[model samples]
Each structure stands twice: as structure tokens, then as C-alpha cells.
Target: MIKEKKVSSRFIYFFGAFGGILFGYDIGVMTGALPFLQQDWNIENAAVIGWITSSIMLGAIIGGALAGQLSDRLGRRKMILIAAVIFVIGSILSGIAPPNGHYFLIAARIFLGMAVGAASALVPAYMSEMAPAHLRGRLSGINQTMIVSGMLLSYIVDYLLSGLPATMAWRLMLTMAAVPALILFFGVLKLPESPRFLIKNNKLDEARRVLSYLRPKETLESEINQIQEAAEQEKLASQNTSWGSLLSSKYRYLLIAGVGVAAFQQFQGANAIFYYIPMIVENATGTAASTALMWPIIQGIILVLGSLLFLVIADKFKRRTLLTLGGTVMGLSFILPAILQKVIPDANPMMIVVFLSIYVAFYSFTWAPLTWVIIGEIFPLMIRGRASGVASSFNWIGSFLVGLMFPIMIATISQEAVFAIFGVICLLGVAFVRIRVPETRGYTLEEIESMEESRQAKQKSALLERAGL
Candidate 1:
């Protein structure tokens, strides 16, 4: 039984976060495919390239919203299964899109975006629900690890396939997503539903069984009772909960904290580098696309290493501290590149990659993974699903705008100017974290919610005293 518990817990965590692999692969695959696709299609329009790259984010916005509503009604596990199916279908459609017609490819990518959006919102929530509070940060961070692993895998695929004919190379890079989507489908099929969900649905026996697989025998009963108590209160509060509940002044700080972290995670300009690094490198140094592909692999390795480090430190430190330090470093990294380019016009372009690596090192361990971790932790259970979805939409909104505008920005202003703008955003992110985001480490979801309520009460009392009430 002890061995079974270990195996079951490992299985649950691995597959629970496995959806991120698909999410990362789809996001990274485009980096390699775009260079070849542009050459093959003889495309020169920056807007078209931006559309092809960013269309998935647009779809993700919709997917995140829809999945949030549905997952609340259905279950986290079931929503993942549904997303896996969408992943398979979308991957195939994306691969088969015809040459010279951006519309079909864009449409297919948008279809795939639904799965990406769903995974973004679902994986962290699912993992958090299943994990013990002490381990939630590390366990939840695994989704990010899986995401970067998938990205590294895609970068390797892109590099390996770079030598093939342009059309064939990009096509194969996309179609390969189906393989993992199928794996996610089969893998998730056997996993138990979240114990929290079970308790919410009043399945006491099943919740006990699920918790047994996750928690030790000593704590299993107490954990289940705790979850039940939270669920009972959540059920009462949910009677008044709706999408509008997020806007209530009582919870608005939580909403700001969750959504601000998510939005800043993207607006820091990380994806802009991920999606267009080759182009940036090529335009800067006139390097061939094939040679430029090697850089992503280097960045991917750093990201993976940083993610590994995050697992070690995730539960040890304050979330706000890590984010503030990371935001500061990331802001500086971008700012230095922009400043150097302005100061010395003939500076080596490779320095941009160096600074970016510093940025990625901080991001992989900090804002990238912790955003989802905090989002999963901060919301009230009654509104976790909808609020998470809304936060995700804001995240994708940042991603979509960055993806679409980065190229246009590069074309109009210089790369240095664009980098400067991203740098400023990163610094602003630090301010937001310090002022608004709560310290969520080592707290249960119930505890975090209560803490937020207390914080809200304090703020209200302070306001009343100031108003002479």
C-alpha cells in the first residue's frame, strides 16, 4: 500500500502537468516553423507573420474563458481530456494548411489555441487541488518544467528539421504535436479526479480514496474533512458567485494580484524573444536562419536548468521576493541591451542573446512558473474556475498583443527601442508585485483566502478611519 501510494502520487503529478508539454510545444514550434514558412510562402508582410504567430493567443483567450466555465461545472480532469481532443484535431489541421494561404493555417492555429488556453488555466488549478499545501509550489511548478521541456523538445525538432525542404520541415514540426496530445489523452484517462472536486460534489467515499493515494494514511482523514469543510463553505458562497463576483471590491485585490502577475509574466517580453529570436538575430547580424536556430536550444537549456532550480527553492522562499528580484534583473537585462545599442551603434549583436539568457534565467524560475502557482493559490474556491480563466485571458491578452506587435514594433522602431519598452514594463511589474501580490508560500488555499479577506478588512477599516466614519 505504501508503494502504491508513491506510484499513484507520482503518476497523478506527472500526468496532471503533462498538458503543459503540449502547450509549450505548440508555442515553441512556431519559432522554428516561421523562418521556413516565410521562405517557402515567399511572405514579406509583417502583419501576416504576426497574425500567424499570434492567432493561437486569440483562440486561447476564448478557450480560457470557456474552459473556466465548463471546468467548474464538469471537473478539472474532464476539461483536460476535452482539451486533449482539441489538441489532436488542431495539430492535424495546422499541419495540413495549404501553402500561400495564411488563412487556413491561422484558423487551424486558433483551433489549437483553445487547447493551449485550456491547459494554461487547467494544469495549475488541477495540480494545486491535488497537492498538499507544503508541496504545492514545487508540484505546481512542475507544469512550468513540463512546458519548458516541451519547448526544448520543439527547439531540438526545429533545429534537426531545419535542413529539410522548407515546406516539409515546418509541416512536420506542427503535425508532431498530435503524438503528445494522444499521450496526454491516454495518460489522463486513468488518473483520479481531484480530491477537492470530489469533496465539492459530495463524494465522501471517493474523496477519501483519492486522498489516500495523495496523502499519507495518518493525515488522510483529517485532510478530507478539511477539504469538506472548505467545500461546504464554498458551496454556500457560490450561491452568490458568478463572473461578476470577481469585480466585487471585497475580492478585487485578489483579482488584481492574480491577473497582474499573469499579465506581467508575458508583458515582460519573454515570448517576444521566444517567438522572434531567430528573426531578431538574423536582422541584427545577417546570420542565416538555420544557424540562428541554435540559439533557442541554448535558451531552452537555460530555461530547463532554471526550472529545475525552481523546484528546489519554490517552497522555501517568499513568492513576492523572488518575483521582485526577478523583475528587477529581467528589467535590467532588457534595458542594458537597449542602452548599449544606443551608446555604441556598432556593438556586437551576440550581447543581446547574453542579456536575454540572463532574463530567461530569472524568468524561468520566477515570474514564468510562479505566476500560475500564485494564480492557483490566491482565488476563493467559489470563483477559482472563472477567476482563473479571467486571469488567463489577461495573460493571453498580453501574449497576443506582444506577439502581434513585437514584429511591427521592430519594423517601425529599432530593436533597441522595442527592448527599452519591454524593459520598462518589467520594472513596473516589480512595483505591482510588491504592492499588490500576497505571500502565498506554505499556506493552504483556505488559509490564503482567509488572509485575503483579512487584508481586505484592514483596507476597508483604514479607508473608514480616513473618511471619519
Candidate 2:
């Protein structure tokens, strides 16, 4: 019998969670910074401001698409390095953008989107690959936590710099990203490449070395053996299939489920709130716009706390159950605001803020992190890169649509109507998760793959028998 080996949670946490910080920071930073950017850049209209806010997502759509293919070819570590470079460039360009040309700012936002897209795709994959089976959910959940933490940091930065002139404050906010980017670049360089990547590249010796560092010494050999077996299985599976096979009747359902979950997460209107909470607060409170902007920071703090709660409980509960419950909560949150807005027309500002706060908290606890963890862990390894890209692309596409149209929607319709639409979408999301998504909390990647292979073989055998072959 093979011996079981213990692993260090610290090593996994440090390396895995670092990438998430960037994700969170990027999410939080832009929301607060946008008000200052708009003021400084002379963007007076809401539509233009929305465009400026979403430009990064448009870039991210492209970046996420490229990340999967590139990581598949170049490996995860290298892709992260590339993302860091893009982030630095985007940050610097955004910070120093000339006031005369809005296009420069748009371009810079797009560049940052690319970096975010790449990191979103790669970080989870890397964390999933590195984590021990028992700790996979918790470890992967760290990515989301870091993302929340980053969002919180952005809020703090924006609050502290709220007093600065628009140009200097925005520049300082954007440039601060460089500090983390530098740290991420140098820190990642010191870490070994993923053993899975090494194994796929036919560097068995190097794979073993990396595994030794990743796991306890006693478990290294068994882990290496397991990885090799998995690599061989993946290679064999790839021999007959291409990306086209993802559409085959047998595999198509999984793709739909994966992509649907991803799309719904965005459609639930979480990001609409994220990208425009400052504006939303102003609308609700009739407070001076700058003071209203502090709402995003509140949103960020709640997000961090909610995500932390999810991390503690994620492995303990069924993913589908948690997702459904979260979705329902989110849907209710959206509807409450819409109802209050329509009924009262002039409700208390504190009441509006309280409901919005609850909405943000619900999103953080359930849908935000769970969606990512599910996407990263659900697919078989062979198609993981391509499939994850497809899912992430769908996510970005949904985010793009929401970001692009929310300004127009809010103008044409009311904020109540916009949120009402989101409420409906969240209800649909809850239904989708309830009906389609499977529980995958305790299963190892290897075990999940085995189940898929077994199912496929059984199907193939039945087909052959029916044909009398």
C-alpha cells in the first residue's frame, strides 16, 4: 500500500493566494478611481463614463481568450509573468494619461483588462494544480478572498486620496498597482513551475523535483506517480479529440453547464453594482457625488468579509446548494431596492444603503468565489485550458454587456428597472445551478477524471453493442 503524506498549508496559501491579491485589487481599484478619472478627463456624460469603466473588460475579454491558449502552450508561470508586464504598462499609462485624449485612457483601461483577464484564467488553474486534494476548495477559495482584499485595499486607497486633486489622486491610485505587480513578478520567479506543467512538457525529473517541494518529502514519490498516470491519461484522451470534441453530444452538456454557471455569475448584476456603486450611491443618497463615492469602499469591505465567510464554509457544504441559496439572496436584494424605489419614490437613504450592503454581502458570500472555484475544478484536465477560457470568455462577455448597457439602461429606464432586470437574472441563475451543476467538493481531480472516463467508456461500449460490433 502507498503511504499517505501530509502537506504544508502555509506553502500552498502563500503561493496560491498571492495571485488573488491582484485580482481583488484590480476589481476594487477601478470603481473608486473612476470618479476621479472622469472629473480629471472631463468626461461629463454617464455613457462615456460607463464606457471608460468597461474598457478594461473589453480588453479582458481578449486577454482571457488569449490566456488559455497561451498558458496551454507557454505554461502557467510564464503567462503570469506576461500578465505582470501588461499590468505595469497599463497602470503606468493610465496614471499618466494625457488630459486631451480620452482614447489614451481607454487604451490604458483595455491594457489593464488584458492583464486581469490573463490573471483570472491562470491564477485559479495554477492554484488548482498546486493544492492538495483535501485543501483544494479552501486553497482555491483564497483566490477569491485575495480578490476581495484587493477590492478593500482599493477602497482604502481611494478614501485616503479622496482629498487630492483629481489628476494626482487618480495617478497615485493607478500607480500603486506597480508595487504589487513588482512583488508578484519577483515572487513568482522564485517559485517552481507547476508539476503538472512539467509533466505535460515531458520533464519528468523536473516534475518530480517540483512535486518534492510542493508536497511533503514522504508523499513526493506517490504524488509524482499519480501525476504521471494522470498525464498519460490526458495524453491518450487528447490523441483522438480536439476542441471540436467539446461540442460532441457526450461532452456538450458539461460545457453548457460550465459556461452557463460562468455567465450567470456575471448576469446576476454583481459587477453592475461593482462598476457603478459610487454612482448608485449618489443616486440613492443625493449626497455630494464625492462623498457618495465612499459607497464602493463599503461594498469592498462587505465583499471581503462575505468571501471570508464563504471560504470557511465552502468545503463544508454542497456547492449547488450554496450557489442556489446565494442566488436567491442576491435576487431578493435586487428586488428589495427596486420595490423600495418604486413604492416610496423617496425612501430613507440609510434604508437604501442597508439593502445594497446586504446585496453586496450576499454576492460575496455565495456567487462570487463559488462560481470561480466550480469552473476551475469541474473540467477534466485535458480540456481544462480551453474549457476554462470558454467559460471565462462568457463571463467577460456578460460583464461587457452589463457594463456597456447599464449606463444607457439607467438613463432610459430607471435604476429600479435596471436592478429589477438583474433580480430576474439572478432568479434564473439559481434555477440553472439547481438543475445542472453537480457537487464536487471532496473529489480529487484524478477521481473526477476517472469518473468521466468511466462514463465515456460505458457509453462507447453500449453504442458498440447496439451496433452489434
Candidate 3:
């Protein structure tokens, strides 16, 4: 038997999930900083402002793809370290951009977005691989909790800094992301590599040592055997580990479910509410910018509180069931306000805020966290990194389009119409979950993979029988 230092499970969970904090902070910080930046730069063009806001997502698209491939080669922990370094660099550059440097700021945010995208892809896989199957959903769900907490932190920071000089306030808000990035960097240095990754790399002794600490003593050997078997099967069956292999019949369903869940989560437009809530509130209620800014804090609070609730139900509930219910409620929340406006013709503007709160409440506990949870659980180990990158890229693509277009869409169409469109997408998301996604709750990663094989075998047997073979 090989010996290794035992790492704290709590520390592993906290730091493994900590990347979400930076991801959430960068995303939320811009919401508060955008108005100040636009004013200080004397920028009146909505499209230009939209580009500045959405540019990080464009970079995230690249970051997810790059990190996914790199992590598969370098290990998940190393990729996270690289991402933290990039986040620090990006945050500092964003803070120091000179006057009328909107282009520079956009470039910096795009650079920062690369880190955010990498974290978005890396954290779920890391947490999933580290966690016991029984606790994987809740353990993976911790990343979501950290994300909302970071957003809440950013909103609070924005409020505290808003009273400063416009130039100084936004800079501080943007640079604050570096603080957590540094923390994550230091903490991750001591984290053990994922046992599953170790097994795949032919580091069986290291895998066993890591698993000894991660799994119960009585079951540790059995767990090691399961992972070792899975790794061997994958090595034998997969001749090519390229991205193209994901398109084969064996993996096609997993890809559709993984990528579709990821894509739809953003397409439903939660970030539109997050990135632009202040603007949306100001437009609807005719409130001063300062008062409008307070709304995000409220939304942030609801999000954090709701995310806490998910830690309770994550393992107990079926993935598809929570998704279906949350999507239904979210769809109705958006659609109801539109209908109320049409019927009443002058519904209380605060009614829009109330509906948005409801939407956030449902989303925080449901789709927001569960998307990562399901994606983390569903993919096979051989392609988990590349497939996750593909899913994360699709997610960021939707987020980028939604972030860039919400302003433009609202300008050309009625706000009511735009929200109505999001409502329709949310309902469509529910249908997608019901028809395409599988239930992976209460199953080990090895068991889930085997379930897929059994499913494909049944389908093949049925077809052969029908042909009288």
C-alpha cells in the first residue's frame, strides 16, 4: 500500500468550488461598473457599450476550448492555476486602462473572460471527480453557491464604492476580482489531483492514495477497482481521443444532452437579468441610477439564499424534475408580466421587479446550479474534458449573444416582447429536458457510464430482433 498526506475534504470542496467566485465576480462587477465607465468615457452608443459588456464572453468561448484540451493533458488542477494567473492579469489591466479607453477595457475584459470561461469549465469537472457519487450533486452544487456569493459580494462592493469618483469606483470594482483569484491560486496549490484523472494517466498508486482520503476506508479499494476498470475500458474502446470521437453514435446522446442543457441555460436569459438588471429597472420604473443600482443587491440576496436551498435538494431530487419545474416557473414569471401589461395597459412598474424576483428565486435553486451539476455527472471520463469544453463554449456562446443583444433587442423591440421571447425559450428548455436528458441522480460515474452501454445494447438488440436475426 502506498501512503499520502490526507487533505481535508472541507478544504477540497471549498477551494475546488472557489473558482466560481471569480467567475461570478467578474460577471457581476461589470453590471455595476458599466454606467460609470459609459459616463466617464462620454460614450452614448448603446452598441459600443454592449460590446464592452459582452466582450468577455467572446474570450470565454476561446478559453473554454483551450482549457478543456489543456486540462485533459496537464491535469485539471494545473489548468485552474493558469486560469487564476490570467484572471489576475486581466483584472489589473482592466483597472488601469486610461481615459476614453473603452477599446482597452473591452480587450481586458475579454482576457478576463478567458479565465472566467476556463473556471466555468474546470470547476464542475474537478468537483465532480473529487466527490463521492452519493454526494456529487450537492458537492458539485457548491460551485453554484460560491458563484452567487461572489455576485452578491460584487454587488455589495459596487454599492460601497459607488459614492467615490466615477473613475475610481469602477476601477476598484473591476480589480476586486483579482483578490479572490489570488486566494484560489494559493489554495489550489495544495489540492490533490483528481483520483479519476490519476487513474487515467496510469498513476494507479497515486490514484489509490488520493482515493484513500476521498473515499471511506471500507469501500476505498472497491472504488479504486471501479475507476480502474472504467479507465481500462475507455482506453481499449477509444482509439482516438480527439473531439471528433464525441460525434460517434456511442457518445452522441450524451453530447446532445450535455451541450443542450448548457446552451439552453443561457438562452433562457438569466444573465440578461444579471448583467443589466439596473438598466432594466431604471427603464421600467424611471428610477434614478443610484436607486436602480439597489435592485441588483436584492436580486443578489435572493440568488444566494436560493442557492443555499439547492445544497439540500440536489442529491434528493431528480435532475430532470427540478429542471422541468424550475423552467416552468421561470417561464411563467416572465410571461405573466407581459400578459399583465397587455391587459392592464398600465400595470405597476414594480410588478416587473416582483416577477423578476420570482424568476431569480426559481432559477437560483434550479437551472442555474443544476446545469453544471448534470453536465458534470453525465459525460464519460475519456471525453469529459473535451466534451465539457464544448458544452461550456456553447453556454458562453448563448451568454455572449444574450448579453450583446439584450440591449439591441430592447432598443428595436418592446421590452415586453423581448422578455416574452425568453419566456418561450424557458418553456422550450423544459421540453428539451424531458425528451433528451437522462436521470443520473444516485448513480456512480461508473454506473452511469454502464447504464448508457446497457441502453445502447437494448436498442441494438431490439433492432436485430425486429430483423429476425
Which candidate number has the best TM-score?
Answer: 1
Model 1 agreement with the true structure over 1-469: per-residue lDDT tens digits: 2222323777877787677888899889999889989998998888999999999999998888788678878999999999999999999998889878799999999989999988877887788898887776466667788899999999999999888998899899899899999999998888877878878777777778778777889999888888888777767767879878888886788898999998999999999989988998887788866569998898899999999999889878899999999999999998998888878978998888789889999998999888878987898777776687778778899999999999888889888778878999999999999898888888877788789888878989999999999
For candidate 3, the per-residue lDDT at 200 reads 83
Estimate the TM-score of every prediction: 0.90, 0.88, 0.88
Candidate 1 accuracy as lDDT: 0.86
Off by over 4 Å in 1: 1-7, 131-134, 202-223, 242-245, 380-385, 442-469
Candidate 2 TM-score versus the reference: 0.88
Residue 186: error of model 3 in Å? 2.2
Residue-level lDDT for 140 in candidate 3: 56
- List the pairs of residues colliding in candidate 3: none
Task: State, as a TM-score between 0 and 1, how close model 1 is to the true structure.
Answer: 0.90
- Candidate 2 per-residue lDDT, tens place, 1-469, comes to 3322434546545755777787667766777787777777766676777777788899989988888778878999899999988888888888888875678888888989999888887887787787777666576567788888887887888789889988888788887887788878877766667788988888887777667766788888888788789778867777867899788765675678789999999888888888888777776666655566667877887888888898778778888888888889888887887787668877786675677688788888788888878887788766775677789889999898888778778878777778878889999999998777766678866676566667679989999999999
